[model samples]
Target: MLADGLSLAKMNCFSRKLRRTAPELGSSKNELVPSKLPRINGWSWPLHGFQVVGWLVYIYLAIVSFGIYIPLLPPPWNHVVHALMGIIFILHFIAHIAALTIDPAEAGVRAKQSYSSPVPLFDRSKQSHVIQDLHCYLCNIRVGPKVKHCAACNKCVDGFDHHCKWLNTCVGGRNYWCFFVALTSATLGVLLLAIVILFIFIQHYLDPNCLRTAPQYAGIQGNTTWLVFLPLAPVKTSSAGLLIVAFGTLMLSITCLMMFAHLMAFHFYLFYKGISTYDHIKMRRSKESNIEAGKPPDVKTNNKAPKFLQT
Candidate 1:
């Protein structure tokens, strides 16, 4: 009886050990083995923060592209601007779709360093493994050759550049050309129209009817004329000039911000050991107590030479 009890106890211990080590698989192809894998749930809030900021840009783009239409402009220019605006909207929609379709967790792209394996390698035999390997852990989505994931869109995007929330689309390889075309056309069109309006305002400014008015310079100098009124001339102050300046400023600011972000991100990714912004932030937090107590990072304790490198 004692021997029998001993065997049963050993079996129970082995079963518990198996339960502790076994990696759980999910039902769907896209579902991840949550128990064994790392996760980026903390990143969702920051991503949503960026999305909220993007919505503001979208509203501005929408108002300028669709709501404000001028009848005085030539048919060709008007049609061109309208067409570009429509394209921007479509691109934005596609970006959102891409984000939803590509799940970062399933793709093996976790925001937190602890959630992902240090190497992020796979055998390439399993479909899920293949997908995750293609994605790489640094970013969130699996894309094809020559394609990269857009952080802003939170998905694996094709030929990806930065996401333009204003257009609501991922600037991927497939649509980069279109995005540039729309941007260039819209900028030129706004400048041209602003110039025309300034010219018209100048012409009216010089009219003799201005001098005979009861409030001398009343119509010419009213709040609308001075503050909001736009002249319709290329050379002088008009609605056209105002619009061109405003749009030009907007374009410049957004472009500069995007460029700065890209440069910073690229610099870190290339120079560092494939570490990301998320990793840096977490590392900092993890070491905060140690740093305050005058200790070094945990890495220092485990700084051993690899066998291959030693050889």
Candidate 2:
């Protein structure tokens, strides 16, 4: 009888232990659920690699055109090459600005905050749809649809893409067009300069005297004249001049071709989709459409969206 009593006591103890542990197991399962989705990390790898390479190539070309080659060229053509290089350089600057301005799509929130109270910290419910109307308690700001706080910029930008390290700024809605245009112009300018340089090289190679002549200076107090245009009239057969032209031309041609190809591809994709680099990265797939017919609908508020957002 004692053994029977002891067995009953052990069973009861086992049941109590299971009951006590059940809540803990349930809590652990809940912890696995993520509060929000991850945002865009940065530029796509291919675009990043391409931009780095292009920048390096353009910088190298700029050095050669402005610092080394142009100063040594003869009158007329020297001035022409210098003018071309200046254009290319200016375009590069524009490209830098464009890269700095963050696109709307690339921008994203670092963290999200939720409040249960009907009173919003910032009145956004009247401006946005229920899903998009959000109040960030940390910032004490109201964010609209597709709006995100950028930690890098320390502010919210609509449709923000990732912060561009190259530009040292965020690429967003306001500056994306300029950035793209700058890139296009820079690429084109580089190509033109490359062609001109290559032509000079080939002409010199065929006729060494084509690039050689009296080195003319164009400065007031010093020998600091803008490199004049290359004297295109004389077609000499100087071996040394031909060699210099050949090497310079080859380098410029290669760099221009590569830049052209890359920009062409970038623009083609941008135009095909009618979206900016920022937008392509952040917009999510339609999750609402995936909901089953019988599932309870998401609670929506009759909120007025921000002016920047699509209706």
Candidate 1 has its poorest 10 consecutive residues by lDDT at 302-311
Error of 1 at 6 (Å): 5.6
Best by lDDT: 2
Q: After superposition on all CA atoms, what RMSD does each candidate show versus the true structure?
A: 12.5, 12.4
Per TM-score, the best of the predicted structures is 2
| Model 1 lDDT, full chain set | 0.43
Which stretches in model 1 have alpha-carbon errors above 4 Å? Answer: 1-143, 150-154, 208-311
Give model 2's TM-score versus the native structure: 0.49
lDDT of 2 by residue, 270-303 (tens): 6798865545432321223224334333522323
Question: How big is the positional error of residue 62 in model 1, measured in Å on the Cα after superposition?
Answer: 8.9
TM-score of 1: 0.36
lDDT of 2 at 297: 38
Summing lDDT over every window of 10 consecutive residues in candidate 2, give the lowest-scoring window.
29-38
Q: Report the C-alpha lDDT of model 1 over 1-311, residue by residue, as the tens digit.
A: 99999999999999999876644453223333222232233223224555566556545555433433322233465466557656646664454444433333322333333433432223222223223335443333454543443333333444444445444445544554454544443444444444434433454446524312323234454323222221232122445554565566456445634554564455356347644333344455556645766877574433222211110
